[model samples]
Target chain A: MGKDQILVRVRDLHKVFHRGSERIDVLQGLNLEVPRGDFLAFMGPSGSGKTTLLNLIAGLDRPTQGAIDVDGQRIDQMSEADLARWRARHTGFVFQLYNLLPVLTAERNVELPLLLTPLSRAERKRHVQTALSVVGLADRAQHYPRQLSGGQEQRVAIARAIVADPTLLLCDEPTGDLDRKSEDEILDLLQALHREYGKTVLMVTHDPHAAARAQRILYLNKGTLSAEPIE
Target chain B: MRFWPLLWSSLWRKKVRTTFTLLSILVAFLLYGYLAAVNKGFSLGINTGADRLFLRHKVSLSILLPESYLGRIGATPGVVDVVHATWFAGIYQEPKNIFPQLPVDPERYLRLYPEFLLPEDQKQAWFADRTGAVAGRTLVEKFGWRIGDRIPLVSPWRKQDGTSTWEFTLRGIYDGAAEATDTRQFLFHYDYFEEARMFGKGMVGWYIIRIHDPKRAAEMAQRLDSNFANSFHETKTMTEKALVQGFARQIGDIGTIIGAILTAVFFTILLVAGNTMMQSVRERTAELAVLKTIGFSNHLVLTLVLTESLLLAGLGGVVGLGLAYWAIERGDPTGGVLPVFFFPPNDIVLGGVIMVALGLATGILPALQAMRLRVVDAIRRA
Candidate 1:
């Protein structure tokens, strides 16, 4: 694979869930590709399997019968242990609710993923400082999630997601719980991460405005992915 | 950044719940310490010197042995010296007031038991007057007895008529060399008892023999018993440790009782702790999913939960045992019912082990549940 080539390759992926004796098919023969350093957003209705597709790409869930290749690794076929290591090294995640550990301070929360790495204490401290500075939460490093406002908490969550310098950053409705002003700030941060740091981004959201901030937008309709023209 | 700080804060997140849980664990370990001391007191004979042997009547401890057999026992090949004593079972003030009132050959008894530390003046006073007695320091303090104070003694076995009643002047108060040694015994001259008693004049309760070599105790015991074999009153000779252990066993199986009580206590504690851990993990379901999404492996999550549980239980255990040690040092909260209570170092070690085991047992299920959580579902629920 060459530079600026396809970084994620999904071919005919299907995901089905079984509730007792009833089978619910979430995804049906989906195919998609994301170029290196591209910021792609997914918009879909409820139960349309946009989150399922993102989870599969992030190595958090397995596909029923298909192939998912991220960073040149067939993550769908990886064991649970190997997949976890893979996720740690290559993937960062931002949740809609900002998913910051309530007991930890903002800096400590950002340093969570770095614990999986072999970095020294000084190195980890530097990385945490950098991540917090990038998100404009350097002064709020000592504040816990409960101590910060909604937008500040999301910034800390974003800092935590990017602290380890993961190859891909997956956001699940990153602005779902934020006001318009906070959403604009978070969208600007995501744009800066993609343009300045050359980070690949995949986000699943229901808001068209959140999708419009991405370089490319895909709509999931009737279990099939289709590009929506950005005007 | 480190697992330690994360675990510490997680446990303290709900201060009230954690404090109460810790208090329960503290109570459990405190009970463990005191119960362990009581068990140690009941099973009190394993620490005796092997050179000593106690020879008693084979039929029963209450049965009398012939005093003439003492000479033969002393003449045995391995015998160093033979001392004889008889229980007077005397009561003072009321029937509830009880103490060891044994009459012994004072010189021989004191020589055999060097652990009973007595002053030279007290020894001479007892030997000087046949009607004088030596009491332990604890007994003297407990009853406020002073030197030259005549103590009236009554025996239930013997009718305490005017002539049959006994009185002795307290001449000395003895201390114990070691904590396990009993310092509450009342030792008087056997010559006085033999002369004053109406019946069983030449009979003694038991004979204590000191051997030159402790390893030769079994051989000497066999030789002494064989000498009294088929005689008027046969003898059963055993090491002093074994004899004390037998007496302890006759009361009840203290070790088994302690084990059962501790088992019940720990089982209830396990349920309480396990329920708390389960609730904690359950409430943090969404947070755990966030951890997994951020690349925390399943094993790390499980270990984090377990470590939190261990920290909670271990903190409580140390505090509780520290309190127990303090109480033991303060001495007999029950006011002398348990005379030989002590908190041995080994009991502290055992309590620590129980704390760790309880932590593991209570945390394993909840930790596994945390490990098996599906990140997608947890995030969805949140």
Candidate 2:
């Protein structure tokens, strides 16, 4: 799709958090456009607020001073419940540590997001199985988190993110906790999902190689977005 | 929601802690059940005690009234029949082997309660012989008293010439037809003790009046008491229930004390279980935060945590109730004091309700924390 078919559009977005005595500005007058099916990466230092901007785009948090439109809906103005339902229908998320509930097996962890929808048990099982198979962990579906290796757990997390058939996929330091080999494997999975399934992936990371795997790389410094050149 | 598997796995994770929690709930509910059953154990009106009421001398229970009063009281209004008795306050050959020995009029006593299942032939044989006695089933088993055998009871009050054995033949052993009273008392002919003639001459300790309508008992007691008031001896009459309860109250306010203890126990369980749920939810802060960021509604998260806590409590409650059932069924050290001891159905239901309430109340703190946590901070906690 063209840039006119942007999946995420932010206009002068700002976020401020209250910590005991004063306010801390995380995102200051940010702007961005993410087209449908584009693999994009946001690279920044620890306190640069890249994740804050992603949360706004994913409808996870409200921006204090601006508007965010994701797939034609202005999410900043939606009610918490509406935003949650919208996020369930439109957004998917992956984290560095996988964040899988230790108690659930791989398939059940993948099946978590589907529980929010009105899908039948069979439909849920099918979705979980397909997602796990997509991540090449179909055989590991019955294994608990403790039974899996780190990279395997992350792949399961990715499977969970996409199980709901969401429009936007968000990853926060998706390979920050993995070894180089595992990181490359994860980047490969992200690339495959983007290229084959045509998913819109917004990743935040410090690793340049991870960003190089994206169709576009953007830099965020002190709550402002800038361009980045990937080799 | 599909949270059951999550809860089950979480409970199974730390086996020792889970087991400890379950056991704690078990013990708590056991105490609750026993206390509740102790409350139920006070129900009287069975076998030996229910069918009889001691119409004591008007001045005091210990005061001996003349035999002439018994004939008159038996003919009073609402009176079906009457039996007169004197407490021997005896011990079996040994000083420590104490028991209540009663000198009773067998003929009229046999007419009062038809539920005391004794053979007609045995009753006739015992009533014909002056020195015959009928022991309760429990008493018979207790002392191995057989039919046509002699039981020598030593009375402390009616001793004569330093000898106290009031020997009587055990013509028959009887069983009570109700569930309440213990079958552990002894009954025999009063003429035997009176015929000894060494003590209590022409006098009876008390009279027991069996009424036709137990509901009109209060008025009957009043009539019985007024009939003998201001005489050389006076009578204090009461219903069989009131008399039994009065005897129990003489010990202490056990039911009230038990009620206070149960209230305290329930409060403690609520706090302890609530605190436990709070700690568990706190431990899952980051996970809950992740749920929020993934678009779980504040309400869903709140309900999820609360349900998790209640699930824990519910599981604990079932185990506790089960343990309580076993303990009560097996009996306690209070041995036969709580004979009808069992947890009431409502108590188990109450436990369920309290578990849900305590779990929800405690979970609210952690859930609110989760709902209020900044989404950015939540994910940042990593």
Q: Best candidate, DockQ-wise?
A: 1
lDDT of 2 by residue, A1-231 (tens): 575589899999889989899989988999998999889999988778877777778887778999898888888999888998998889898877789888789998888888888898899999999999999999999999999999999999999999998999999899999999999999999999999999999999989889999999999887788895323
- TM values, all candidates: 0.82, 0.79
Candidate 1 chain B: 10-residue stretch with minimal lDDT:
B156-165
What does the lDDT read for residue A18 in candidate 2? Answer: 90
Instruction: Give, for candidate 2 chain A, the lowest lDDT window spanning 10 residues.
Output: A222-231
Clashing pairs in 1: none
Q: How many residue pairs clash in each candidate?
A: 0, 3
Q: Model 2 fnat?
A: 0.71
- Which runs of model 1 end up more than 4 angstroms from their true locations? A1-4, A20-23, A229-231, B46-52, B57-66, B75-81, B87-203, B210-253, B334-339
